[model samples]
Target: MTTLSPARALPSAAEVALARESSRTLSAYLQTRAETQQIEIVDDQGAAHPVRVPVSALRLLVDLLTEIGAGNAVSIIPIHAELTTQDAADVLNVSRPFLVQLLERGEMPFHKIGTHRRVRYQDVIAYKERIDVERNKVLDALAEQAQELKMGYE
Candidate 1:
């Protein structure tokens, strides 16, 4: 597990709470893309990049930012595409911890940058496509049954 050191003099509880109450969604955890802050990250290919992020994604970025400010999260924002563990989780509509399980199970490919892990956009898309195919198959079976009933009482 990665150890995170809390930043000094970051946003106060009142400030975060106010932000939370305003958004009333991510609970100050995430803001809109335009409103959220920027963060930098490095990809598996050893390339540095910057990532423009929304609030949910930016929350983690903010922590990473305050940890190693400037050249840290904000600097690497340029290379962000299908990035971040939480973003992958968002794509899958599951928790980040669960997505980490998928990564461990070899269901998704991810790479480690220093202590952080990053997931690819294509991998999430492929997983989504796979799920859609399975769901379609079930729907098709039900449709076939409906067609049979339409033909007769069976």
Candidate 2:
């Protein structure tokens, strides 16, 4: 039920280049194998240590690296994590007041603890997905209408 902290700042130019290279190399290695792989890690003291990593974790790391390589900030939230209203609003890219309105309207489920409200991470994600689908549908309908009216839409 722990909440994740805010996303880190975007990767710097050097970090982005390193992430892109590392992601490419790791992705290629992953494609060749499905089992746990041993990778060497060098410490600041120049001592090399071999570590065994699960394929699943490596895949997740690759995804994270890819996003960082693209200069995007990233944060990981567990599906079952509970979030504060501000955290949920940040995830939805909406204001906290607007999110409270949605909670009051039951657009997404939430529960109150004492006086503060808490929302499930999965519920917030599901709500966002539903909103995105509806937005796409509306945009598609508008495009179709424009085409029918020959309003310079093809």
Candidate 3:
């Protein structure tokens, strides 16, 4: 399989609008249809061709389009794919040094390819989710404490 380079920017306003419309169409079609069998694609010359698309691939496309529609830049990396430290850092929105620290501290699992450490995409995502959940729990506790103390306007 061929891997595409990462997109470096958020979608343009026009692209986002188009993506939103396409996402809505996909959503509506999926909602009404019992099963997705095949779809027709129109060429630039207005020629229609029927093609078979897997339901899983279609679902992924819909999700990607939805994210793009929300003005977010999306990356398609397989869950089992391995990533470099810098790539993992970028995905987690953390500094490379910090990611290294996490790896060193055994917070996330990694395997060394020679001298270089490689982490699985799934591992990074799991770590991010765990961090987010912990952060949310702390925030919730703080909010409760603040409410008990009657701090600020509820």
Backbone clash total for model 1 is 18
Q: TM per model? A: 0.41, 0.95, 0.88
Residues 1-154, candidate 2: write the lDDT tens digits. 6977757888899999999999999997787555798889999999999999998889999999999999988898888999999999999999999999999999999999999999999999999999999999999999999999999999
Q: Encode model 1's per-residue lDDT on 12-106: one tens digit a residue.
A: 55556554444343334453535665556789998989866666565654455453432232223222354678877866789999998998998
Best of the two (1, 3) by lDDT? 3
**Pairs in clash, predicted candidate 2:** none
Q: List model 3 lDDT by residue over 15-65, tens digit each.
A: 999999999887765653444547899999999999877666778888999
Report lDDT per candidate: 0.64, 0.93, 0.87
Q: In what order do the candidates fall by lDDT, top score first?
A: 2, 3, 1
lDDT of 2 at 40: 95
Indicate whether candidate 1 or candidate 2 has the larger TM-score.
Answer: 2
